[model samples]
Target: MKLQKVLSALVTVLMVALLVVATSASTSAQEPKQNDGEDQTNLDTQLYLIVATNQSVADEKLPAALDSVVKQLRATLPFKNYRLAATLLNRVKNEGRLDLSWIGAPIISAQSEVSPLTPSFSSFKIRVVKLAKNTAGETVVQMAGFNFGARFPIQTMSVASANAVPVINYENTGLQTDISIREGEPVIVGTLNVGPSGDAIILVVSAKRTSR
Candidate 1:
């Protein structure tokens, strides 16, 4: 009888041990998995627009902060003379807006529009379509549905006349590109011809990871 009681006690202990083990396994399964040195957090990207011009404009015409960028571009780009026409700083998310405006010589005009486009002011409306990381671990951003507008002078340019103010408008829905930028690192995504007189606009983008 004593031996039988001892065996019963042993069985109870074994059952309790099994129950504890099962509970531990279940709890672990319900817990979130740990990230082993992988970055699972979403990143916030910042975009900086650097508009370089071959012709120098008054310092008062540009934002005060752009003076440094202009100095850097003068040393880097092949242009003998370049000035920072405009600087646009923006942040990135699922969907955002980028509005840019600058006063300079008009470089691009619609073919259907009259010649000698005299618009000296330009503006852009850009939409951020998507932001995702690619398989190669590069953060890619896609932008579309962008439009560029130029204010024309009162006069119009034609084959007979060389002077005219003609407002030019263009839509670029297919303006999309992939950019890989680390925190505080700037990369030039692309360039736009701002003037027929050899002036160009350079777009520099940068990003940094933010806490959720």
Candidate 2:
């Protein structure tokens, strides 16, 4: 009887070990496997909008209608005769939806002899409403609105006040209408005026499409 009991205990141990292994194998099979090219197929494309302001200074006093508020800028600004004002980026899809992003705080430098005049409100927000290929086979981007505060310096005082809120509609085409931007590419659309005087706050815009 003692020998029979020992043999039964050994059989139970072997059964338990086999059951554990089967359970582990089942779990492994249920786990999902990743495809080698999955990352490439699921890559996303992004769009970026770069905005820079150019201020033109005249030696004589600016006209009353011409609102002038100048601020010194870093010598390392990208474009000549323009300051690195603001930059914004957005991810675009073909879903026909609008995208909005806030621009960084205005970089207002103190007045200097070199660049003493600048715009009051240096920063604003932009809305990209639509993107499509037109009949001309051009990639056109429709801007829903450009919301910004119109600031004018208080006469004889250093303080500035918000005068008006303006929303403007704009449209532009791709750099090369013949070439489609499947990968990363940049195109300069156009320029806009932010100040009361013409060209006071010149907004230089460039659109870029990139894939990740």
Candidate 3:
């Protein structure tokens, strides 16, 4: 009976020691799970995005555009809030722009000048199309002649796929267009006809410039 009692005491002590050790380990892990210093370091490392919008686009549109720009930023990077600005086209040309600029001291200067919707943005333009009309109210197009006449540029431009007609028309057309491809290559645009309404598409085509 004495031997059995001693053995029972040893077993109880071993179980108590094991519980204490496990509790200590768990407390240690929980204590360091959220360190203020480490959290501050993470915040310091977060990135930023700068958005630029045209003066013509309404202020209400800014919110929707901002949401889209934010979604794009999230898809490309890991961040939340982004900077917003309303800038002119001329200013964008002179200044650089971006929707998401990594926060770092080295690229700060260049990031300040970048406009998110400038010619330098990737996926800007691979194809170009425009439509116009004369005084007679005849439908004008850059490439086509009829229902299919309005879809010529997409059919011919190298940027467009073989069967990708009209898909790249961009619907609207104007008088003169200056489309800038990658490497600052300017593709001059001209319109051949307008629609039957005779309302000539009088517009100055320029490289699309927006901060978003």
Among these predictions, the greatest lDDT belongs to 1
Candidate models: Cα lDDT each: 0.52, 0.38, 0.30
Ranking according to TM-score, highest score first: 1, 2, 3
Q: Is candidate 1 or candidate 3 better by lDDT?
A: 1
Candidate 1 lDDT, tens digit per residue, 74-122? 6778664443433444445444656766765433322243344343566
Residue 161 error for model 2, in Å? 22
Off by over 4 Å in 1: 39-45, 51-66, 72-189, 194-199, 207-212
Q: Single out the weakest 10-residue window by summed lDDT for candidate 3.
A: 39-48
Better of 1 and 3 by TM-score: 1
Give Cα distance to truth, residue 56, candidate 2, Å.
9.7
Clashing residue pairs, backbone N/CA/C < 3 A, model 2: 69-117, 69-118, 70-116, 70-117, 70-118
Q: Which has the better TM-score: candidate 2, or candidate 3?
A: 2
Superposed on all Cα atoms, the candidates' RMSDs to the truth, in angstroms, are 10.3, 12.5, 22.8
On TM-score, the leading prediction is: 1
Q: Sorted by lDDT, highest first, which candidate order results?
A: 1, 2, 3
List TM-score per model, in order.
0.42, 0.34, 0.22
